[model samples]
Target: MAKMRDRRVAPSSERRKNPFAAATATRADKTGDSASDRKLVTSFVLLCIVVIPAVSVLLYYVKNAPRASHTISLAHQRGLIKTDVTYQEILTVISENASQLHRHYTYPVLAYITPWNSKGYEMAKRFNTKFTHLSPVWYDLKSQGTSLVLEGRHNADMGWISELRMTGESLVLPRVVLEAFPRELLRNKKLRDKAIDLILTECKEMEYDGIVLESWSRWAAYGILHDPDMRKMALEFIKQLGYALHSVTSVRNNKQHLQLVYVIGPPYSEKLQVHDFGPQDLQSVGDAVDGFSLMTYDFSGPNNPGPNAPLQWIRLTLQLLLGSPSSRVQSVGWKIFVGINFYGNDFILSEGEGEGRAITGREYLNLLEKHRPEFQWEKNSGEHFFLYSDDNHAKHAVFYPSLMSVSMRLEEARSWGTGISIWEIGQGLDYFFDLL
Candidate 1:
């Protein structure tokens, strides 16, 4: 401490010229730059891996979520939700209860709409949401010499097509009873193939969802039912048509296979002499087609004085279809749709067989509203009737099904996990829509 050490200071020119010192300072600067570059690259990687996906998820949810006001308004319009509450309150309620009622119902509700019926378009618009399939009873086939041809022209109006499509429903081509029975066509393979080809071509051109084959042939006739040859021909024709139809993809729905529905009369009882369909035929046809629409109604018309479709008869008919353990019903219960009549049969008190008339559901409801007659609901039969004197001064008994009857039928269908279809639309009262 007492001795003073020699203080040596390097010249400024020497310090600037020292390459080692310069190299050391440059290494420190490069090390700091490398650390900053690593930090920037890490941040960029995290943004791509985490932040991008988070933003995408947020955008997807926003786009797909239903708007509260629109959903609430639609519910109110459908009479599903009451309008007594305030808009804000309804929004909250709808948000909370949306999952309970929003598209909750399963099973298809197919409605037959005839072009001749003036109310067809209006009814389609009014009840489009309720119907899963809208079938126009428009087309048929007829024998043209040795070949079969489309009989009636399809509806030219394309307006209904777009309107129905907008509702997320399908328009199926309905082939009613051709002038000549289909069995006759089936007898000739050449004619059957030609007919099926034409039908498939038309379906592809018109972009139909599928075809419906209605029961009109006497194949189910007592004489023909005993003929094994005729039954074999009929089954073969169905199988071929089904195969051809399914092979072609639908233009309307590319992902879905074409549907083939067979509409047949109710299964006959063992003792019933006037049976149209046998159990064997039912099983064979059921296996070939995508679904079976059982025409359980029309038990009585103007010709007979009875309920359109008595509950007891319906139950028996269902039993006949579903009774056999080896039958198609057990395996394909969901494919079977029980047909409901939206019309009624009116018989005059003095009329004999075939003396009464068939009236639409709207006509019957109108009578009830205008006359205000003593309405009677037969609980046991699940039918509604009223006694009134017509303009002819003759007593008349009108039998029809009310909403109550329809509800009972729906419950029956649900128990079996089966579907329900209406014979025709644009015939029912407003309240009937509420039940659906």
Candidate 2:
């Protein structure tokens, strides 16, 4: 019994003596587990590092993009047009029969209200006058008074309601007006002098009218988006315009032009439809303009598939503008006037559809009444009409306004106690005016 116990004990004793073997096995197992654990942890850490930064970068760029796609001009920047010989002759002829032409209280220089003014201004006075409109403070635009003070140190001015004509290769403006800017021109004494000389000579040639001075230009619109260089140039250009106006005021004998520089500001014509007002394209259009004249009735688009200017849009737009100037008071510059669509936006189809023609209000109404009697339109207000449809397809037809319709619109405009302007003397003027 003692020998057997000794044999079992001897095996245990031998195992205990081989300490290196046991230790080696234990060490190997521990090393393998530790290495595997380390790999798992490292992979998780690396993934977090890569993914977090990537997502953050993606989110940053998407948030900062432009909303109201801007339109690029095909022409370079230049001054205002002095006159349109063809249009001038035609207008002169139309104005001759003043009694037949139906005159009204008028605003000519609409700095920000062109839509109300630039039509055929019926005001008998050859000299233009406009009511005041204040620029948007959020966009850093100065009102006429503020703008004058800003550019007084420099020499830039505004021009609106005065005239716009193609003169040689450049536009010959009376002066540029606009919102204010944070630019400096005092440093360039030489440039300032040259600008002054040019302005004085031009003012003398033009020979009359008080100065409508403003210091900035369309830069306000561009600034809404943030283009440092472009804003700078625009501001500088406005300063130059001011210099021109300043010189004019110093020498001019006429006082009519100063009392009212009709500002012509706007809703950018080329802009695409948006869910909300955005990318103020017509931002600075009023800055230098004496009056505002909008291309209000442009229903004939190259891509239009349906009726032109809807009454809802027209009325709402008029209301929106009313925020700046009372539609009633704005009537004074009705002569300065917004433009109505007498022609189509294009002669050809946009995406290959119709010939892209524009129908006059009378024609549009006649066509609608003849084709879709079930769809009707009643006059809403001054030269304005609307569609009436009970069918669910959301179909709209242009109904000719009845004599009552014309009368209603005329009365609505008259309520503003202002002037009214027809777009062009030709191209169906009598069609709408006849109703008036």
Candidate 3:
């Protein structure tokens, strides 16, 4: 039995020592090694083709993406964003801390308020007399046949006006638009006197400080300025109105002189043109009016989209209107209030799209939150703008007045020793008043 067992064990040993068997074993081992090596090569290739490239792409995105620290998310925390409560809080803080920011400018600030937006009412009440004049867009002077009618009295708020006056004694001038310019109203002497009397009676009866006349553009549109005789009549009408306003004493206070602020349009070009209101017109009516509110904004529109008011363009317009440093009219700078736009323009980069839609600060904030696009500061325009795509994949460009833009404009106006007339207070950020 031992011999039989040994014989079996000897076969096993012989099998282990057999060259053919060992070669077969080596072939099997080589086959296994080749399989493992193939797997390793395949994995490395996959890493190069998929995993590595994926990781590289992820790294690239991570590196290139806008950091949260630099985005509106962070800006919101810094009180750059607005809320009903945050608005008041931010204004309080600004009033306390940055009140002196505009001290470099000693000129008066004229802020416009509109009935369409309630924020303007709140802003006027809060800031009080930070504005020398508060013009409420409440009235329209229109012609109803032979008679002149001063409408929009329904929008007036006497309680609000009383409160605003008590706060800081800001002049409450209601903006009156010339909705209709009848030839008879300008040509007929009795009708002209009737118009002036109507304006004066309204001011005295309503206890209003004065009126902001916005008829130049309407007159221009009617081609009144084109005709030299009509232009002279129009200018004479303004002078008569101005003198009449200044001559009257306020019903509220006998000491106060009712002011007449004339709204003028920008030339919109470097060259001298027969515009709605030009330097010659200013020279004609400069002494009659308390201040000339130059509409320096709307430098661009949908048909020709660009900066709302380019800094360089504004400078040139000023030079053209007020004359260069060498020939600047004395004391005219004080009377000339440079217009600053608190609103922005949203323009579609397409033809026949009408004009740019006006946007407010809150709307702009909503857009920033939604798109989070890179806001670009155009040095040439001294404005902040951003590009976005809508659901239709149509590109839109927004040119809004940023804090920096306003500051540069304020500085520019200050250099000319001019006051600032904000288009409307409700359309801008609360902090914008910091640079008032």
Candidate 4:
């Protein structure tokens, strides 16, 4: 994020007069007043008369709208309006209140748009230019016989992409997860070439600006990273994919080189083992890729039931990836896009409630209205929490993002001179756009 200049609003001078309250000069004599002058003065006066009153009326209604619940009833009774709009308005108001925390950052914001979260499509269009890259969770690489194929192409919204581009020039990079990685696919040259060709062909056909490739987590889960040969092959495959994407310039996108963003998993533990991608991996593939989308959230889960992502833990993860001054990875910080989670977790502290689930902005608002629990801030984690109970009397804990927590996280990412990445915009509140 860039450092913003400090601005101070100058106080109005005592001599300054209100344009509306100022007295109008009397009309000149017919002989003295030219036709053009008369016409100009009349137009100016008319404009003032119309605009001033309209603005005043708007301000008055706005100032009293929050306290005037009876207006809705009165309008409904007179058959002039419906409560649905009023309910929506109330929900918006509630959302705004929950979005009290606001901070401004000028970093490369890469946001993900999921098909499941319908709201995210509109959110992407609404905040079009705020993001540098929009990775719609659309495509996944799956095996069809011995050859690889790109699935989920049917889910792509071409109209929405065009609409989003009309607003801003954010690169439309659909996320492609490696779902069918054969055991020896990375080591096999022909199979690897086939996968790259498939990705390139799909991207070219769709006229996409680029793609966000996610495979590290899958590789780790499959224990591929545990094998030195396989890990090296995996990095080589990424480098080759990056080479293929970067070598071509899209004719549809004003002759811009196709971007390749590699998604990397965060350091699960402080020990910094080889099972996960570390600084060495970053250095190896740094030049091949445009940027690294670091999955930094999910510090705690249902098993532990703590903060979604603690501030201190995030710092440690970054430290591991970026390294210390003596062993710092050259130019790694600028290329890193730190992940930020807009949603929170609702953990079940006791039995009968079932497994914990992720909480959305709307769900968080509903809980606030239902429980009205007092919020407590965890200084160490830099998050806000509240406790509630269901009819069964089973306790639950919610660790949602608060104004201070979001502000601190943004600033922390800014301090590292790295970009910000939202897991998915749909799960976040509308007001969160204020920060971007």
* TM-score on alpha carbons, each prediction: 0.72, 0.38, 0.75, 0.76
- Candidate 2, residues 1-436, lDDT tens digits: the string is 0110011111112111211111100011111135544443233222111111223223322222212222221111121111211223323333453222222323221221121223322221221221222111011123342222223212222332233211111121222343333333223445444444544454455442323333322333323315545444544554455435543452333432322233232332222222112223233333343433433443323322222333333433443444234224333323334433332221221223433343433344343444333322222212222222223422232322233333333343443333333333222333233222
Candidates ranked, most accurate by lDDT first? 4, 3, 1, 2
Question: Candidate 4 on 300-379: residue-level lDDT in tens?
Answer: 54444556666765666777787653455846667888888888888766423234778788888788777766565555
Candidate of highest TM-score: 4
Predicted structure 1: lDDT: 0.56
lDDT score for residue 389 of model 4: 67
Report the C-alpha lDDT of model 1 over 263-375, residue by residue, as the tens digit: 76663332333234445555666655787777777554333344566565565566556653344546665677788877676666542333566676557756665556655
Model 3: number of backbone collisions = 0
lDDT of each: 0.56, 0.30, 0.66, 0.67
Question: RMSD in angstroms, candidate 4?
Answer: 22.5
Clashing pairs in 3: none
Total colliding residue pairs, candidate 4: 0
List, residue by residue over 386-424, the lDDT tens digit for candidate 3: 666668855566777776678778777766667889888
